[model samples]
Target: MVPVTRITIQDVAREAGVSVATVDRVLNRRAGVRSDTVKRVEAAADKLAYQPDRLAARLARARDYRFCFVLPTGTNTFMQSLHSEVEATAARLTAERIRISVRLVDVFDGLALAEELERLGEDFDGVAVVALDHPAVREAINGLADAGVKVVTLVSDAPGSKRVHYVGIDNTAAGRTAAMLLGRFVGPRKGKVGLIAGSLALRDHVERQFGFEQVMAREFPQLEVLPVREGRDDFEKVETVTAALLAETPDLVGIYNVGAGNRGIVAALEATERSGEVIFLAHDLTPFTRKHLVRGTIDAIVNQDPGHQARSAARVLLSACEDTPIVPDQERIRIDVFLRDNIP
Candidate 1:
């Protein structure tokens, strides 16, 4: 076994160019420190991979924590899965004195999400959000952090915000993986390709699209990508868009739905009798996606485990509450690729 070396306050102080006293004050939640100095100390602690002993902290003082999970209210399979995982996590953590409440919001509305974040008030000690990359939402996160509430971004992220951590897979790598799978499955890559996404405004969707395009340009030069359609995770909207795309591109070889709404794509393909003709790739392996995968309607489903993400996010928040250290790699959510032959 590798010998472990505990990170000390002096190390954080050195990294932040501050005194050990300043680091101790920041870690202990003591006052008499500038805001910038506090950020520096926290950043240094994060960079140094500092982990406090949670067991000792618990023994010293036990406290009940109120954590709020802000989720998008929808029938979308992935959202439903995330919701279930959050509920289950709440139950699992209850004996530890963690109270979790799942709050639903209109996922597509950034203004509404911002308003909801602001309205949370002092009801919860910490908040975990499936964030939209919007300025208003970022402002809300900053406001929450300012109020001494621990915040974590779940699944999606507000990249430049003050959120403590982002619990999700590397979406760009996921997109690239999808592109490689699509390019190889479609025997001759010399046909028009199409891409569908909820919105390019979301960081995950944008990163996935960027990674997909990069791989397609580098490895599959013969395939041409068409302008992406904003499916908005709506079945009817995606169905309409897919139908239009099919009508327009006679030789479309493959299509990757980078966001939600695979149900709509399946519906359109089934109706058009083109399910077997074109290679389809999507994210999330839900019951709908599973059935379609088994039927060979979707060639691959790039997946992230909702339960794993929920558990990791909760653990991270709980650790933060006690000023404990977290293992970075342990919190990483996996990217799973599923096919008809390998449906797990």
Candidate 2:
């Protein structure tokens, strides 16, 4: 039989330079103790090699640990689909003794997202955010990591930060695939193409744009891609901008929507009776886009399963809590391509 080890709360109290009552408060998570004092007690316990029994700890604690989900609030079909998936996943997780909180913010406002991220520091054990590539948001994620919270990014990622991992499709490759499809669809044509983007402030949009432009410039030099028109993911803005581009460039034969606002694009094309005139390729297989694909309005769609994204993101947080290794094959998701014939 192996030898058993013994340690006492009094020993930890002495090592931490605090009284036994303070140690008890820290261990039991009692009220009225400052955070600094709690940190000191935890450090002392670590130094003196105090290990509490796992079953006893669970029995003593009543509050479930929390994980947060932050994303944009929008009426767009894609965002709505993502929100529904996350809510379903959150409900399932709650039954397993975990608490999940969902927060929605406007996609156009980086300041609001940063503020919400900062406020989550004390309330959650882990966080998963649809991050923006901005200094203020980066700082907020770093602060959460510093305070022992696990951070993960979903959909669009914020690289070079303290994010533990990312859960989404490879966006660059998706863009390249879009270019290949459009280049092939518009065979032997010599006309300019128009690109509609959600927002350049997002890293994913920027990367997709880069991949699309590189492919067009190298292999399809006959096709000139106009400067990206910022849609801000708004229907009115997308329609107005696309109409302006159509008027300015009579030879525009194709359009690639790298972000949201497909509804507006469809409406604008219908109004001009050019619904089937331009070769349209877009992202995401939301219900709206699915119908459009069936009707021949959209030629192809590059999709990342939002349901898979939510489930994988939740599993990452649970793995962090359990101190387990994540399986790359299981967590690394795929980007799917949907054509009219292959629509599911």
Best by lDDT: 1
Q: Write the per-residue lDDT of candidate 2 for residues 1-344, one digit (tens) a residue.
A: 99866778888999989999999888867898989999999999999888655444434567776899998877567877888998899899765667888899875577888899999999999999998888888898999999989999988888978999999888888888899999999999899999999888888888888989989998899999999999988778898998888888888889999999998889888888887779999999988999999999999999999998898998898777656678989999798999999988
RMSD of 2: 7.4
Which regions in candidate 2 have their CA more than 4 angstroms from the true location? 1-62
Over 229-304, each residue of candidate 1 has an lDDT whose tens digit, in order, gives: 9988877889999999999999999999998989899999999999989999999999989999999999999999
Q: How far is candidate 1 from the true structure (C-alpha RMSD, Å)?
A: 6.4
What is the Cα-based lDDT of residue 310 in candidate 2?
Answer: 90
Top candidate when judged by TM-score against the true structure:
1
C-alpha lDDT of candidate 2 relative to the true structure: 0.87
Taken over the whole model, the C-alpha lDDT of each candidate is 0.89, 0.87
Give the residue spans of candidate 1 off by over 4 A: 1-63
Q: Give the C-alpha miss distance for residue 324 in model 1, angstroms.
A: 1.2
Candidate 1 residue 147 C-alpha distance from true site, Å: 0.7
